[model samples]
Target: MSPFEKFLKQLENVKVIEPTISYDNYVTIDLSDKNPDLNKELLADAEKFEIYIEDYLQKNNALVAFGGYNEVRNLYKRSTIFNGEDFDERNIHIGLDLWTKEGTEVTAALNGNVHSFNFNNSLGDYGPTIILEHLFEEEKFYTLYGHLSLESISNLQIGDEFKKGEKLGTLGNAEVNGGYSPHLHFQIIKNLDQNSGDYPGVCSKNKLDYYLENCPDPNLLLKIN
Candidate 1:
């Protein structure tokens, strides 16, 4: 197996998010092309989309709705920044999204030092984002936490340390979280490639192979299911 794959296997014993919400309370959500319920019109209205997600969680008796690794979503089509003339559209989600209510507490997935943090305030962006640098078995990697409240990084400095399960921040609302239903975008990046506080959470179909390799499924660590 590849070294990264082996590293993922070791994460089975790790608890990324808090265990207060049991595994059974976490439900998988699909916003990909396979889910017929997710269309341009449905995702266009932020309120309606939020309601849709809440309703789904309520129906499933779940507290958290999570999934979306390598999912090609129609949600970004409205943002020219994502689907602009600059290049091919970047709609394939490279991270795992945990959909929960706004203000829900988020914790660090592993022991790491703060690498960089910033607020990407553009429409359909990550909003307040934080990247942490971690070392496992002598190999270096990165973990990104996005869609966070401004207060999360307000007092944080580069090199600040956080242990696993440490409360890092709270989920931000649409107003502060780049205009979307509240959710935490978590990603495990093999390499930052010189990226700082921000990194592309989504990629185009043409570059799927490279991104898929660089950003592995975070479920490898969360084990939410």
Candidate 2:
């Protein structure tokens, strides 16, 4: 079997979410799969909306419920409109997300080396990130944990090994965790491409095919309903 296939086989029957939960009542929006020309009018409007949402969340203490990969996402839904163009709906999320109160304990999914780590703090960006590499059946792959607490990567050393179920870190609060609810964006990557603590959690419609192949749905390993 290929590296990716081997990794998936190793994770058979692993419980990604301890308790299953419904994903209803979540405010949903999509980024344009189209390149988003970002003309002056569209760029300005997007910026304003982004700022408004940021402030609103700060004042309301509301969290972003579900992100990264969601099996329930209606892949057939219409693509979002940016400026004037309609893009394809590449919204069938492949990663698994843990949307709950902040400070949730994030455990290592499996025994692996610290492949990479970084602090990505931007609007709609992963606040803090860690990627672990797993070798199974002589094949190698990686798992990425995003939107984690700052301390998560404080003392992490690249290539250091962590066992499955080890305390990888905790979830960060809104101000530091990309101004959203505290949750983990966990993704399985077949190839690293030398990226450290970062991978493309979101992909444009044009590149959906490539991203889908390179980054398969993590549920294949997690199998959490």
Candidate 3:
């Protein structure tokens, strides 16, 4: 693990969703190509995908389905954002996803201030997104909350402070959350590289090594494993 990742692991009381839901209610899900139950057909349509996720959650008796950091998935094939003009295909998910109901509360992983937030409106994009700047052990890092409700960013200003587990925003629905099932795309970014409010949550094979290093598995902090 990188030094930042190690520090994250040592931190305490990290929860990104509704604090009422305990850890036991969270289940790990596999959305990679290897998961036979998930297919192109299901991923191609937002409503279908939401239905599938609902069924999976019901079957597993879990409120949240989380996973997909560094997992190669076929879910992006339907979106030209990852495929257009770039045959390399950014299908390798670099962020851990927490799938749950629309409008579910999303909180900060640590005490931090809003770094940047934007409405990345595009097909298969991180619709209302927010990035928080956090400092610990005298080291600075960032946390991104993507696929958020439009209201999430409506009243935000730069440098707004939020305590750990405090409500940063709520999850967005398919209509505004890039046409996917309502979920929080939570990622830990070591460096923003001048980017604001958004970063690549998926990567291509050629750039996987770099992205994997710069964006470590968020589960290291969430400890949802």
Lowest-lDDT window of 10 residues in candidate 1? 10-19
Tens digits of lDDT, candidate 2, 1-225: 555655576665443222223233233333223424323343334334345444444554544333345332322232232112465444445566656556767778788899889888765567898999987567688888888889988998999888777788888876776655566788888777878778867655576667777777765676543
RMSD each, Å: 1.3, 7.9, 1.1
Per-residue lDDT of candidate 1, residues 1-225 (tens digit): 577777776775455455577788899998997799987788888899999999999999999999999898988987888997779999999999999999888888888999999999999999999999999778789999999999999999999999888999988999888889999999999989989999999999999999999998888877776
Model 3, residue 66: C-alpha shift (Å): 0.5
The numbered model that scores best in TM-score is 3
Clashes of each: 0, 2, 0
Q: In model 2, where do residues sit more than 4 Å from their true spots?
A: 1-3, 6-10, 13-94
Q: Judged by lDDT, which candidate is best?
A: 3
Candidate 3 regions exceeding 4 Å error are none
Once superposed on the true structure, which residue ranges of model 1 sit more than 4 Å away at CA? none
Better of 2 and 3 by TM-score: 3
Per-residue error at 76 for model 1, in Å?
Answer: 0.7
| lDDT score at residue 90, model 3, on the 0-100 scale | 90
Total clashes in model 1, counting residue pairs 3 or more apart in sequence or in different chains: 0
Query: What tens-digit string does per-residue lDDT give for candidate 3 at 52-157?
Result: 9999999999999999999999998988889978477899999999999999999999999999999998889999999999886776789999999999999999
TM for candidate 2 is 0.66
Q: Candidate 2 — worst ten consecutive residues by lDDT sum? A: 75-84
Clashing pairs in 3: none
